[model samples]
Target: MKRPDCPSSSHLSSTTPNAGRTWEEIVADKQRTDAAKIPPEWVLPPAVVAGAEARRSLVGAFIEGLLDAETCRITDMDVPDLVGLMESGAFTAVQVTTAFCRRAAVVHQLTRNMLEIGFNNALKRAAELDDYFRAHNKLIGPLHGIPFTLKDQFHIKGLETCMAFVGWIGTFEGNKGTGKEREFESEIIKEFHRLGAIPIGKASCSPETSNNILGYLWSPHNQQLSSGGSSGGEAVMQALKGSAFGVGTDIGGSVSMPASFNGVFSLKPSSGRISMKDVANTGPGQQIMPTVAGIMGRSVTTLRLVLKSLLSTEPWLQDPYVVPLPWRELEDCCPGKGLAKSKPTFGFMENDGIVIPHPPVQRALGLVKRALQEAGYETIDWGPPSNLESLQIHGHIARGDGCPDVWRALQLSGEPEVPQISGLFEPDGPRDPMSLPEYQDVVVHMRDYRNRYQEYWMSTAGLTKTGRPVDVFISPVTATAGLLPEKFFHAEYTNSTNVLDFPTVVIPVTFVDKDIDVGDPNFKPITETDAINMAAYDASAYHGAPAAVQVVGRRLSEEKVLAMAELVVEALSLCKAKGHGPSSVG
Candidate 1:
């Protein structure tokens, strides 16, 4: 009955020399190693580090104040601007790489977000890129010399991918004597390398965005709030402008939630758009709803550039799981599109009816709706299939196997499970896995749910004045602007997209304001989960945290989704210019 990937019961009793060490010691040693990777010149002073620790926010002027003029100039540019600057000979690859590495070093020291640091090697590679540019008198690719980071699940040459598991630290995903340690690379890394994007480091991931390796990652906008995970660290890095762009993996709301909480943009494409080959994951056998890679960046354009660049590599040639679709150039879904003379219609879902969003999130949705209407786009109220279906199917499909591999990985070093995931296993061991028949039934249920949802979407054509389906839908990224540890209730907003295999883009709108965003005095709960979720919302605690909305398109419509997201951004910008946007606090 033992699964091939799960560790045997005998292996649980067999402990390595490190088994005697406390988990705290293992984590501390790893932290020290990451800190030492930063060069002496890039290290922050004791006073500056102390100040940052004492501050509530490190984003905007705070983090930028620590950098020199050149570093500030280089780090502030988006991916396209960075590449254009390098190609124009106005800035060399080394300059851009060093600026981001230095800023990332500062971010790691303050937030403990980085799991592995590869700055020295990154600079060396930047030098080689500069040499190539000098010799050829042209750039290498669309992403030439743009520095970036990844979630720790990715394998990069010379870097270890522990994925926040203490037991997996020194070894390759918990196995020793594997020549592949620091020698092998993930398929996406190869694609990024070919595109000339530099990998500066790897970040931490866990539920609630905390792990033993890097501790908890907090929002740069409001340090009191959690950076939502399991892609929290990547979001924190993007918020601080540590890199031009970063990559993270998302199954549920991992990428979208963090990006929302951190005031950044992210694209969580449907499965198969991006490759997951050779990547380490806890639920490796969950193929029905596989985890897809997502891109986090400072702007919609940056996200578009990263995805388009990756598709240019034809990843399907190397990773069989990847779709063979190339980047399709689509006209903006604006007024000029050839589909119809009328402007695009938007399907707006303010809440799922089960769990209502917090006031800040509601305000964000209102702002987006008004902005779109003011910009000549029609908005329709959207009511898709209930997310209760996704809620049931997500658990069975994502962790139906009882997560024996996760328990086995923790057993490697005898490290205690972080509190966030401790409930996954019984005191003795992992819970019993579901039977094959039951699991298949849930899969069938999931397929039926997706079909019904699509049918509902198709039915919208009858509701819209344009006589066509809405271009894309808008909704809250999460129930709250920022997460308070252990306060998360429902994830259906983002989880439904995963279940339906829909492409989504997160667009930051405004920040939480305790002065204005308060609970409605006459509000009544629709369900038990809604009451619990609303009771957890503390406007005072969530103040200054970013609130965002997501633009969701049908499956395999990343290009159209990004374009529509840009439209959302444009609408919001115009709204803010006219002083009609939601009030934001620093």
Candidate 2:
């Protein structure tokens, strides 16, 4: 079975009339149609586009400078705050939607992040929301009037689901006569509609966030670095405040890694905690390691709210794959929950003993550790089941079928495999799939690995001063702060959590400081991959990139994980107040 996303095609290059045109024609039509959606006034001038191209950073002042003061102020506010303003009638849904749509337009032009533009439709829906609010004299729901974007993998009623494949451009997941085009809506979209959130656009989705479609998406924080990917475009959008929040699919750190790289907050929950129903996915019958939809936003608060809102819809009732777990406020886990009890203990894993993160990431972990300690929380060095164990289980269980579907999807339009995923295919086609017995063996290994990991987590209670297992463990989101294109060399930090099926949240800690984040000169390599990862690190090249950490919790622990993330954010803010915070460094 192919991935749920259905691989993309190049072009039919129709040999007969009415067959199809060239890949170039498809790409041009796609771009032209998407561009037509943006209001004329939102179109960017050539000079400004040139200026954006010349800069290393397009975030903060750079991107905002292009927008009007109101749009900047509106877009800068996080989701919860924006919804609050709407509830108070200080801002209408149209106002919020228009602000984000305009800013998203500017961002798409500058970064090529948007794969499907829906500004006109978004504004129309926003008006309906405003009318409902006016008639009801009350807010519609928790997420009322918020604007959001999603990876192009989700089928929205008024937009295309390109998934960044040129051949898949005008069709519904590469099927020409499916009749579902623009008619079928993903389950999540239904939930979002009920909550009153308007989707402004769908973003680019590629193996490394690139394809023949919208081009490569660069990190808004540091133009020289990768936006992290398959969800890279969504991460870049959130980093640039293109939307109030974003939804991305993650099979193996797809959402978390990009969020970390783009300097945005993200939540990659245990598979069933969030609905994957109706979302275009990566693999089929691949439940041993299923792809999950994750939320990315400017802050943990935004991530928390979005997840909670989705849960409030009780998506499980409609999507069979969703775990029937309602949003657990887990009030007892929130700050000030001590009430004479011990504060939450935390686990810190600076390295997996396989690959050492670069200096920027090391500093980020150090900052988190110190902040947690200073805030009166107990911290312990964490050593769980070796990530190498997970490294073994992930790929086989994920693509044991050899991803023949991906090849066929690309072949539909005669599109060749992309460089990032080129190695995934053979010279002629996808590699032969592992036999069922072999695949089953890998599944058994994954089961045992997960069991061992859980046991190890529980055993940590014996090591913590609090006499309780650590509430969450902090680890690097990736070994690199910002990727220098293909120089990225490790995914153990993020992928291990996926294999374990644990819920994880990523928080941006600080900017990569070429000076302050100087790495150890006498470091010894633990393994060949480690050596290559370290050797790939160039402090100057990674500078200006965001350094981040992931807070990981046990399976189905999304609420607790989110609460812990807030704690980290608070602790870091406290550290900054003392003038020695990671934020103070760069």
Candidate 3:
């Protein structure tokens, strides 16, 4: 299969002339048009918007306070429930789609996370699905009539995918006559449409989740903290219940970090599990550590539903990059079927021996450990190969080209680099690209690192009483519960998974409690990065932010990873019931 081009949107306007407009004007016009796309009935009053801005958190009660009971009831339902309701004729596709579109519109107005709005188009598609259901008297597919949003990297027939770049707003990836603007769609988009899912909008993403188009996306759980970047907009949408689920891309912790910070569930499958053909990306030349698409939802079941449905379409037939493996129900079973009759053992890594997680994160890990122990699972201390190696390999491979393409994209629209990514380039232009030999040397190092890591994992069989390696391992999703502007220090927890191509899941555990998650005043630093990361932790500032942990499995083991994540969720629930879990607050 031929890989399609993943270009950005053109900077054109229907209301204003495309030419003779400043970059600022173009950006402003797009924002205005996007806001205008929301239905008048769905628009929030200025007072409501002001009120939401003033609040510290907009999740749960705060967001529900702004919606009618019907809207709340409809939007709160997960994908399975929504599908069941539609299939039983309890709700029409238009009704479900409209409720989410209205809520998404409100979410955008308050949070400014939306880059392209397709409310009208989404409703039209919903109506078409309803008509098809009426004519055939059967559902379209597993995801029929379910509404979703994605990071702006994806292309939808009527949606603009600029990925937050101002120069590519109206044209096809900054070109004037490409003729693919709003006409071409990504492979995943096509698959979702066939599965009966509707695309409602696209989200803004940047290095730290803030962007030129939508400003900084704050976590709805705590407005003071960041939602997380590159996929933060989608995370915010999911946290706000703006859509049933969402899609985001991750190269290094982009999807997992935001999902962690925003307090939602996410599955970052290994590369090739999902199709990324024709998706807009920055490091297209760096195929060695290619970006992979990830799914974010309120529940693991929703994530499973999406991945399973996509595989049913045989995505590899259209995108050679997608693995031919279909969803394996047998692989999802735990401690069952043709294997060990004994209880499963888990590998636990409290810290990377470099940077320790913040207090809330530490508490969250403790909760998981205690819960699993109470549930009769053996937990082992996990000491993998140094993340320092993954860090070196990741930095070299991810930016070996010096990001000239990113620099060129910004130049096309004259938009100043967002503060989050300004350090990537020099004063005037990109730095020198690495030589071929140097790049190859790093690649060899990466291979050797993967080998050593796998060997270390397999060697655990000698330590376990069952004579089997750990079923899965658990660790912090990041060094902090929620990001505080530019205070991010470590990515190895997530970056290692990317280097090894391991499938991972992010499960929200508890909220950050300032009184309990206080910093250790007498702590000693293990490394320079460790000291810098720990010093940036502010319990009072991160109060009420969500804290989460990551569960990792070997490469292409999405089913097992997701199943283990569900196990973690169940264990946490059991702990909470017994008052041993982390505190819960709205």
Candidate 1: residue 69 Cα off by (Å): 1.5
Output the TM-score of candidate 1.
Answer: 0.95
**496-568, model 1: which lDDT tens digit per residue?**
9999999999998888889889889888999999999999988888888899999999999999899888888
Error of 3 at 202 (Å): 0.7
Q: TM-score for model 3?
A: 0.95
Candidate 2 — which pairs collide?
Answer: 3-282, 3-283, 4-281, 4-282, 5-281, 9-167, 11-413
Model 2 weakest lDDT span, ten residues long: 1-10
- lDDT string for model 3 (46-132, tens) is 998877777888888878877899999999999999999999999999999999998998899888899988889999999999999
Residue ranges of candidate 3 with Cα displaced over 4 Å: 1-19, 331-342
For candidate 2, the per-residue lDDT at 580 reads 84
| Model 2 per-residue lDDT at 334 | 77
Assess every candidate by TM-score.
0.95, 0.95, 0.95
| Candidate 3 collision pairs | 8-173, 9-168, 10-169, 10-170, 10-171, 11-169, 11-170, 11-171, 12-170, 209-229
